[model samples]
Target: MEKFKITDLDLYYGTFKALIKVNLTIEANQITAFIGPSGCGKSTLLKSLNRMNDLIEGCRIDGNVLLDGEDIYGNIDVNLLRKRVGMVFQKPNPFPMSIYDNVAYGPRTHGIHSKIKLDEIVETSLRNAAIWDELKDRLKKSALGISGGQQQRLCIARALAVQPEVLLMDEPTSALDPISTSKIEDLISELKERYTIIIVTHNMQQAVRISDKTAFFLLGQVIEYDTTENIFSNPRQKETEDYITGRFG
Candidate 1:
């Protein structure tokens, strides 16, 4: 049930190397978290999952990032790859349009124009994101009008509307308050039943609470990768132990 197999993956932004010899296997329908301090390669590696880093200027990659045994960095249609692997950013970035339009955007972009199908997709996506009950009556309202947590959930709904197999979240709850953060945390746990989730987070507690596996990154390298319990409670690496004990990041 391996969803992704990354082998000797190295990434660079112009002259600076962001990731070095990164190797990991992400399994199907499980939550894997990338944890580290700022400037670590966690986020860079997350973006590389769907080739999102390709948008950056002078960004270069070597080695293989495979999804379902096919190399994503090899000969493949980038757009289709992206559709299969959706992403949500650190901040809640709902489109300026109405809520319904926001959720329907991806399906529409992929040529799902039938209103009947769109309605079903929108409802299912919102429900999957755990925001349908809250936003059901306000579908026509502008997405910007919602609160930060609601907006973040809405963004998740938007990602789900595309029917992606993998969901890549980059510090998705970092911009929210404690209450909002908890809600999104719960949502993330539920999501792993359907999609293989890879989240980059600075919150070790959150990672322990939600992720099945954890990868601790430091200075562009993964110091340790293991089950969440082992990573938090019995980490083999001194750097990981130090990090979990709050001795240093």
Candidate 2:
């Protein structure tokens, strides 16, 4: 099942064209990776999925981005669209509150006000993100006090609390150490069974390790997209081979 279908997509920031004629289909309950060097429109296309680009002044897009067969750019409510498509940023951005409150924030935003209901959502989301066992005793402690890796998992739990169908992650493990990065990689593996995940990563190994499909982008265009094994071992494009082999990014 396709969770998102993007066709003839073009995106611009002010006068600069950031993406051009992009087309792709993202499958449900699987991990898809976008890999490229800096400023190659990988993040640009990711932001367009849920209209995060709408917040930028003079940002414009031309094309169709469909979520579950409905055009997200149409008359849909932006808030509701966001609820269905949650995002975790490059950095861990937990609220400066208790761990429990951090996980409960999204449900609260959607009018889930009961304390009992919030508690259940908090616990379930934390467990789903594979962080409940580590943080259960510290639920009342400040989220800012945790380790960087734990904080990232907390952010994931927070996103999960909204009951999102898709998770958009932009270099989620970039700032973490090797051990922390490994934990996140494991969590992503577990997460794909329930939620469709789209990630932008500069780490080729990480993409190979976690993603089922890989899309290689260059100069604002997707040069190749295919299964992760095929992309890593036998890409059709010379540019892809060069990039993956460390000849150049």
Candidate 3:
């Protein structure tokens, strides 16, 4: 099933075009990585998936973004759309609360009032994120008190707690230590069994390691998109070959 279809997508920030006629199909229950150099609109295109650009005062979009065959930008509710497509940033941003509260925040906001229900949801989400065993005894501790790797896992748990159908990650492992980065990469592989994931990563090795499909971006355009093996080993375009071979970024 197709999770998202972005067609002729163009984005602007006060007359500066950020994305130029970008098109792609993101499949359900798979990991798609967006790789490119700086200022290439990788993150810009990721944010557009859930309409995060709407937060910017003068940002505008000219395109069609379909989520499950429905036009998300046309008449869909932004708040509801966001719930279905959750986002996690480069940094581990846990609210200044207990670990349990951090994971339960989304469900509570969406009107889940029963204690047992919240407990069940939090436990399931943490386990799915592969951090439940590590933090099971520290549920009441401040989220800030945890280690960086644990904190990043906590953020992932928090996003999963919402039971989102799609998860968008922007440089999710860039701020972590080597071990933490590996853990997150492993988690991404496991996550593709349930939720569709789209990640913007500058680390070519990481993209090759975790993603099933790879999309290479250059100067706000999609240069090449195909299976990870093909994009890295047998690119159809010279630009993609040059970028991957370290000849040019």
Candidate 4:
């Protein structure tokens, strides 16, 4: 099942073209990773999926981005589009509130106010993110007080609370230590069974470890996109081969 289909997409920030003629199909219930060196437009394309680029001034896009066969750049409500496609940033960004409140925030925003319903949503979301057992006792404690990895999982739980169909992660483990990154990697492996995931990572190993498919980008263009095995073992393009072999990014 195709989750998102991007067609002839071009994005620009002022006079600088950030993405050119980008086209890709993201599958449902699988992990798709975008891997490239810094400033290669990997993250730029990620942001375009959920229209986060709209928040930036002078940012413009040409072409179509479809979510579940419907045009996301068309008349779809932006807020509803965001609800269906939640995002976790590069850094762990929990709200300045308790752990329970952090998980409950999205549900509340979507008009879920009953205490019973909210509690169920929070618990289920945390469990889905593989963090309920660790944080159940500290539900009332401040989220910022948690460890970096735990905080990232908490952010994942928060996104899950919104019942999103796709989760977009932007270098979610860049700031975490090895142990924390490992935990997130495991969680992502588990998450693909239920929700479609698209992640932007500079860590090729991480991409290889967790992603089912990989897209290699360069200078605002996708050089290659294929199964993780093919992309890592036998990439077709010399650019992809060179990048994978660490010859050049």
- Backbone clash pairs for candidate 3 read none
Q: Which of candidates 1 and 2 reaches a greater lDDT?
A: 2
- Point out where model 1 deviates above 4 Å: none
Give the lowest summed-lDDT range of ten residues in model 2: 240-249
Instruction: Residues 1-249, candidate 1: write the lDDT tens digits.
Output: 999999998899999999999999999999999998788899999999999999999999999999999999889999999999999999999999999999999999999999999999999999999999999999999999999999999999999999999999999999999999999999999999899999999888899999999999988898899999999989999998888788983
- Looking at model 4, report the run of 10 residues with the lowest lDDT sum: 240-249
Span of ten consecutive residues with least summed lDDT in model 1: 240-249
True lDDT of residue 38, candidate 2: 91
Q: Which of the two candidates, 2 or 3, achieves a greater lDDT against the reference?
A: 2
lDDT assessment of candidate 3? 0.93
TM-score, candidate number 4: 0.98
lDDT of each: 0.95, 0.95, 0.93, 0.95
1-249 per-residue lDDT for model 3 (tens digits): 899999999999999999999999999999999998889999999999999999998899998999999998897889888899999999999999999999999999999979999999989999988899999998999999998889999999999998999999999999899999998999999999999999999899998999999999999999999999999989999999998888884
Model 4, 36-126: lDDT tens digits are 8889999999999999999999999999999989998898899999999999999999999999999999889889999999999999999
